[model samples]
Target chain A: MSRIEGRFKQLAMQGRTVLIPYIVAGDPAQDVTVPLMHQLVESGADMIELGVAFSDPMAEGPVIQLAHERALASHTSLSSVLTMVQVFRETDATTPVLLMGYANPVMHMGYAAFADAAGAAGVDGLITVDIPPEEVDGINSELQRVGIDNIFLVAPTTPEERIAQIAARASGFIYYVSLKGVTGAGNLDTKEVASRLKLIRKHSDLPVAVGFGIKDAASAAAVATVADGVVVGSALVDTLAQAFAGGGDQAVALGSAGKLLKQIHQGIANAAS
Target chain B: MTRNTEENIFATVPDEQGRYGVYGGKYVSETLMAALAELESVYRMLSVDPDFQRQLDEDLTHYVGRPSPLYEASRWSDNIGGARIFLKREDLNHTGAHKINNTIGQALLAKHMGKKRVIAETGAGQHGVATATIAARLGLECLVFMGEEDIRRQALNVYRMKLLGAEVIPVTSGSRTLTDAMNEAMRDWVTNVDDTFYCIGTVAGPHPYPLLVRDFQCVIGREARAQSLNQVGRLPDALVACVGGGSNAIGLFHPFLEDSEVAMYGVEAGGHGISTDQHAAPLTAGSPGVLHGNRTYLMQDSDGQIMETHSVSAGLDYPGVGPEHSWLKDLGRVNYVVADDDEALRAFHTLTRVEGIMPALETSHALAYAETLAAQMTPQQMIIVNLSGRGDKDIHTVAEIDGIEF
Candidate 1:
């Protein structure tokens, strides 16, 4: 099993819910990002999902889009993001890092080079927003060869046959989109997510992480009850945005990250109890 | 260059990297690298699936009003005093433009991917209207990103999209037009990459979209090929069409690319003149640069920043041509030229008066170039132009220019 799967399994054995914190890498600035990522893990994050910034991020809402703009202004390329991952791994290597983003940049870099670089940077898995199961054959083989997990997404709209296809191709874990709209646009429907997870469970033995509108501790608690982990992004990005807007203080930004992750982790612990 | 193949025109010229010539390659930020790779895999699987092809054909035929009429413009031909001219009337398709052909195919792909939300960017609003229409039909929540300037200019299309149950979001960034709207739409796709599908309006963007849109719009060329052969007893001597991102031009030219005997011309919008900065003729004046998602001929300065383009026609105001068209120009398969604002205006009025067909300002550029080209050709020569869209949406702009509003 991969490191992420091993970590999740260990958490499951301890009756603890996995808290996955997501952030757009280079958002605000690269200097601040590595420290912030470390802060999230130090506080309570079990896994880290580092978002790769794309110029045209079709599925993002305004907040994350602004975050991407900030990162782009800093000229954050995929290589730069991998460097950040490498820097993080220097201090802490056990926590699994999943690079999440769209598919265009990877295609531009060529798949083999990307897989090698990502694996070298200590990236455990990948979650591309647009790639479906039908197209995973070549890339999946390449990633598997590099010992990197090629994660798949299963939405509420996914048909049973497609779910089975995705389950078969997916590795590390499956990401369950909580709603139909862009991130931060709509409220998450816990009952609907629970039912979707139940359906996904029948197809894949992989752990499923629910995301897209898991805003606060309550929503995280709700998702933890049904999902293997809860992925929080926009809310954490919003916290960082607020902190940055006030002033460029590392302590303030790190404090906010710690507070947000602690709240969600506490909620997850309480729910499990 | 294989002469005969069971596969369609798209299967003929695959790029060295497995792309569709130079048209379909992923050019995006590093963040989107993984996602695009995954999407490319899914697209390949679905492209050859018999079930997918069958379903797509059914939707195109029954839903999108396929096999659009091939009407010979008798009056216009007589006025030109030369060879007969035929129009493959894609404007008569559902949503009043050729945009639906692409939207329907993309919406289906979105459904197959289990995406429940559809998003699109529009300049003239025809694409937005079409995307919204299909999204509603497919029971998917639709969101359209339009530049603030476009929303003000294409008010009717905005209302139409909203009436069709889509939320129109006005983008106020960059140049505050189609490109900005496109940027916003891409941003949205990146954030919600898992559950949302972006229905690009034209034959542009990164790999898959340019190829995919061209494939969907290929119905125009496929039908016209048979119709012209049946009506005129042979193929036309020349095929002419406008090139706003070159979707319509590609749709018409693709089927005829291998026909060495048939000449093809793509009319670019020379807003004022090619020498001036106020034009959308990317192939004529711009160099190859990567923007949005793919590297293609783009109107940019020496500094590489995308330059602002001006055109009377909102639809043709974009600063880039589709990547496939760029490749075709280099390969010498099709001739790319430009038509100025005055020439297009004259052609627009002439077609409305002589043929009683109010052509869109974008299409008028093609007609304008055809008129000039026809003057130089013999009476025996013939031309086939793709009437990509109707002029109804452009009536207001025409009236404003002529100082006579309805």
Candidate 2:
């Protein structure tokens, strides 16, 4: 089984909700990412998403957009992000690490070549933000050939027919954007999320992960009850931004990120799975 | 290179996925796919709907001042001592530019769809002003995204949009130009998909946008085609228009695509020169790349980052061209060329002095090229140039460049 499937299956047996904490790799410093990836796993992250910085990240809101700019300023490219994953893989093999970002970098690298490089770099899954389910068949086959999970996102505006379509093609888990806006732009309506997750569950057995507006531990816990996984991205990225702005070094930023991830993990753990 | 492919050139376009020979696709986020799909369906229904066509046609006639004149530049042609040059006076349209054509159509569609607000992105502010005027007329809340640099350069047009009650948002992003404004507008559309309709200014963008915008703008070419036969006693031997996102050019070219006799030219802004890396002539100097929701030719660096483009004309200061234009280039149906800043400026002056018409700097590029093309052709032959907009918005830029105070 794929790392994402195995991890989700393991968490299902343990009756635990999975916490997927995302961080743009090589943000504060290049050398700090592998250590941060390890720290996230240590802090009870079920899986980690390593964001490869692109010049234009349209799906992301201001917080994550700033994180991307910071990461890009340090010359953190897709290859560097993969190298970070490769380094993290030397110590831990079971924890899933998904490379997530826009499609242009992959297009620049060529899909087959990128799939091979990502597979060689120990990437378990990928979430190309701009490519939707309809446009992913070629990339999906290429990634699937090398055992990489193709994760797809379903938006609030996505119709029922499209939700079924996305669930059918999706291999890892469905990232249900809890709000209609870009990531980190608005607040999540948990009541609306719970109602939508039921609709998604009716279509497929694939685990659904709710993201895009989960701000604090309280929001994470509420979403964790309805979702198989909870992804806290902009919140963690915002914390890292704060730490760095406060003259905290990369070490301090990663530590703050780790502490927030742990608290969010704890919140998810406390929720009824 | 392949002339035999003409049979299927315009027949099987878009092919259900909105691709024009692998040049266009929905290269957007999942958050926008449904909206696009919804828009495509709505467009498919309404584009052929009699009532929608009636409403749109009525607005084009009464509101937008359509069937804009096809005036022959007799004195300018005589001075050039060559081909008889005719001008499609799109500058005479409502809001002082060709932009009102597409805005009125989209605003009507937005009204029909029950959308309460419309958003647009502009560089020269002509489009933003036109969209704002239509929104004010249709009772929809309007917001226009223009780059900070563009707002500074085109302050008068910016003030005109404000007078129409549209919220002008100055995007302070990369390059602070039209491309950045477009990015911001796309972001806003994704964020507020429930109530706002994106009234795209050009024929570029993802799917139904290129298709729909071209449909709205093609009235220019359709009218020009009939006007040519009526006035010139025959169709013009050649057609020329300035290409930015290529809405105006495509509008004038689509009706002539099958008229194999009518040679077409699309003039891109060569700010300095293509060789110097300071131009916006993507079709002339760029390789194919995907940007802003479609695959097209773009002025991108080796790493796929869109390059900063330069043009004296803010309207044509874009790194990418429309996908249809890209397809047209590959098919060899339309020849893409460039006119540098100085050349466009000279045409700006030449037209004002000879024809008593002040062309927008964007249209002046086409005027500049038409001068050379007409110079080469016989007086018996005719060349029609699309005067895409009036130059009043560019007067300050022209005056400042000449070191003249207001």
Single-chain TM-score of chain A, each candidate: 0.98, 0.97
Candidate with the greatest TM-score versus the true structure: 2
TM-score against truth, every candidate? 0.72, 0.96
Taken over the whole model, the C-alpha lDDT of each candidate is 0.83, 0.89
- Residue-level lDDT of model 2, residues A206-261, one tens digit each, is 88888899888889999988788999999998898899899998778879988998
Candidate 1: regions farther than 4 A off: B1-121, B127-145, B155-169, B172-233, B245-247, B250-260, B266-313, B317-359, B364-379, B390-406
Candidate 2 lDDT over B149-207, as tens digits, reads 99999999999999999999998877789998998898899999999899999988888
| Winner by DockQ | 2
lDDT of 1 by residue, A1-273 (tens): 899899989998998878999899998888887898889998899999998886656567778878877887787878899999999999998999999886656755667988999999999999877555544565788799899998887766666676887788888888988875566768888988888899999998888999888999999998999999899999999999898898858888889879998999999999998
Docking class of 2: medium
Score chain A of model 1 by TM-score against the reference chain A.
0.98
Instruction: State the DockQ of every prediction.
Output: 0.09, 0.59
